[model samples]
Target: MILALDVHYKDDGSAKSVGVLFNLKDSQPKEILVAYLEETDEYIPGEFYKRELLCLLKIVEKVSMHDLEAIVIDGYVYIDNEKRFGLGGYLWQTLNEQIPIIGVAKNFYHGNNETVKQIYRGKSKKPLYISSVGLELDTASDFITQMPGEFRIPHLLKQLDTITKEK
Candidate 1:
């Protein structure tokens, strides 16, 4: 199964992390997991993983590691050309580098070229930035480009975002 994850922060110092499991061939999620974190690490500039990684870990506990083909996060895996560990990278390490983690971001990270791939979907000229660990950059980009969607963001991914934001 391929899992996509996203986190929504609330003003009360809480957060909701949502995970959607789907096959590459499917357009819909097979299972959706939601984790409510009563308190999360305060966001630290240049160290975003500290605030969101725990939320992701909470949702990850709902699934078996062996069954995951890859995990998609809503941020970058590598932060720059030198390949610093981002949220997805930290998650990969926490999992002992066993499962692949794909970081899909809506915006470009400046000075990042060696590890980032820009993919445009549908008729949208805007591209989605893609990065990863445990998988070739080209392979990871192909997965995102070919995912079942007619728009810039995959249908299942947008659904996952909505799930995280819903009250």
Candidate 2:
């Protein structure tokens, strides 16, 4: 089973952010994990990760690490060799290392668009970039493209996104 996770922030309030998880079996999602920030808490002392990371960790804790095949994260990673580790790094560190990881972001470093990226679902298409644990950029894109689904977005992640907010 493969897992796809994503986070989207609400502009009106920080508490409105949503975290999404998609459990895939045979290239199709069989489970979904949705985490949201309902209220802001006092900032935790950290330069890379903030209160948002705290809430995200709570969501990560819900997964049963044993059954997972690979975990697909929803954003970019800023690794600092000097810092030892930070929030983004910790999020994955908390997970079972037996399962591999992949991080997909809608937007990446500025001017990174030189690398062609496109998500095709029926007639609609969108651009995406992915940084995975063991896979290269080309391999990551190929993995997402091969996922069997009718939507441009992965079926599970898309479903969780809709459920997290009023639409």
Q: Which lDDT tens digits does candidate 2 get at residues 1-167?
A: 56555445566444433444444424434555656675655554545356556656655667776766566665544332242333334555655345555655565445434332445554564655554444455766677766656656666556555655543
lDDT for 81 in candidate 1 is 90
The estimated TM-scores of all candidates read 0.98, 0.62
Q: What C-alpha lDDT do the candidate models reach, one value each?
A: 0.93, 0.53
- In model 1, the worst 10-residue window by lDDT is 107-116
Q: In model 1, which regions exceed 4 Å deviation?
A: none
Best model number under TM-score: 1
Q: Which pairs of residues have clashing backbones in candidate 1?
A: none
Residue-level lDDT of model 1, residues 1-167, one tens digit each, is 99999999999999999999999978889999988989888989998898998999998989999999999999999998998999999999999999999999999888887889999999999999999999999999999998998999988898898889999
Query: What RMSD value applies to candidate 2?
Result: 5.1
